[model samples]
Target: MKPWILGLTGGIGSGKSAVAQHFIDLGVHLVDADHAARWVVEPGKPALSKIVEHFGGELLQADGQLDRTALRKRIFANADDRRWLEALLHPLIGQEIMQYLARAQSPYAILVSPLLIESGQHTMTQRVLVVDAPEQLQIQRTMARDQSSDEQVQAILKAQASREERLRHADDVLLNDRDLAWLQSEVERLHHFYLSLRGGQV
Candidate 1:
């Protein structure tokens, strides 16, 4: 039987990683789409070879690893290129996620993806949990953490689903604009709620 899954998502700098770690602390297995995405495009991976064939060797560094920053710039600058890259990578990432989830020993698993709703990965889960913060807060946090410029952050935000759209699809929302202690408390509450849900349904 398929294991129960909770899809977790948030925009960049929205504290999804912090919330995910709290769930990890409570013993839930996690499948991260970002990790899967990177895995699929690693040095020896078929996806990376295909990418090189399509975009040229300039997309790879001297170490043969993908030049992610270069690729990011290319895709974000062109909608068609972005769509093409997504079409190539999303299926591979989905396959990786499912394989990991199937092996999880935890009672329930969490699938974390920044593009969960946009990429249709939410369909794999029973529920969607969105971590939310104000747009300005997101920008500030991202700039601090990644050393990204204001324009770069703005471009990333433009690529993701709007904050309101994410909230609209959320089965649960973790408002992460406050301090860490409050966030941890909310995670604990949700952990119990999820456990209760499992008992009732399965």
Candidate 2:
């Protein structure tokens, strides 16, 4: 049977990773685009070869691995460079995601992607679940978690779709502003609901 796919997304620092982990603990297969994106461009991957051809040898470390920090600095500084990198990586990431979903053995699979809405990939899911928090909270959380400066956090947030835009696109919205216990309960409820929808008693 084809596994039902749930596209899970949120703004940076919105606790989307926590929500994804909750679903995973409930036995839902997870295909994380961030992980797949990295996998596709590893030293020996075809995606890395394409990237090297386009971006030149300077983007590589002395050991031949992709220099992620260098790429990040370049992409954020130049819109054209960001687009160029995305064009090369996104399709390869999509292919890997599809392959993972095809091999999933669970009742449903969750694709956790920070850029799911922005990239227009939410259309691929059976449902869209958005993990959300207030902008102030998001900024604070990001700063704390990533050890990033306010300016850096703000810039990253600006690069993503606004909170309102993501909420509008959500079939299910998880407000993650409270304590972890509250978030846990919400995830449990959602898990049961998902199972019920799949014709299983939860």
Candidate 3:
């Protein structure tokens, strides 16, 4: 049988990476959709080739790497383009994640995706664990990390599931408004809780 899968998600800059890291440190296997997304789009990959076919070589640098900025701009401006791109990438990412989870050796494995809830990945998991912070905090963190303009940050936020929506769907929630020590404690607490969920023998 497939081991229990914990779906982890949050909005941009909600500290999901930090949360996931703690789970990793505690030995949970991680199947990251973000990594799969990047992998599937690597140069010469079929997904990348298809993306280039639809979006054009303008989205390719001279080195044949994806011009992510140009592609991001296009998808953000056009809803249809965004859907097409999602259709192309999401399945490939999901397939890779499934392969990783199938071999998971931990009490449970984490399926980490920014779009876990929005893209219906939560339904595939046994539990949904959300990392949450205030919307304003998300905006501030994203802007500082990405050097993104306020408008750009807001637009990315708008495209994601609302913070309230993510919380409402969560089987568990980690509030990430505090310091690293606090976050570490929360993850540790949840780590044991999950282990107990596997009958406390891990």
Lowest lDDT 10-mer window, candidate 2? 193-202
Poorest stretch of ten by lDDT in candidate 1: 193-202
Q: Which candidate number has the best TM-score?
A: 2
Model 3 lDDT tens row, 34-132? 788788888989988999899888999999889889999999899999999999887888888888888998878899999998888877688888999
- Could you tell me how far off, in angstroms, the CA of residue 63 lies in candidate 3 after the best superposition? 2.2
lDDT of each: 0.91, 0.87, 0.88
- Model 3 TM-score, all chains together: 0.87
Clashing pairs in 1: none
**Residues 153-202, model 2: lDDT tens digits:** 99999989988888898888999999998998999998878876652222
Q: Candidate 1 regions off by >4 Å?
A: 149-151, 199-202
Candidate 3, lDDT over the whole model: 0.88
Candidate numbers, best TM-score first, in rank order: 2, 1, 3
| RMSD to true structure for each model, in Å | 2.3, 2.5, 2.7
Q: Which residue pairs in candidate 2 have backbone atoms (N, alpha carbon, C) closer than 3 angstroms, thus clashing?
A: none
Q: Identify the superior model by TM-score, candidate 1 or candidate 3.
A: 1
The TM-scores of all predictions, comma-separated, are 0.88, 0.91, 0.87
In the range 36-119, model 1's lDDT, one tens digit per residue, is 999999998999999999889999999999999999999989999888898999899999999999997876789999999889
TM-score of 2: 0.91
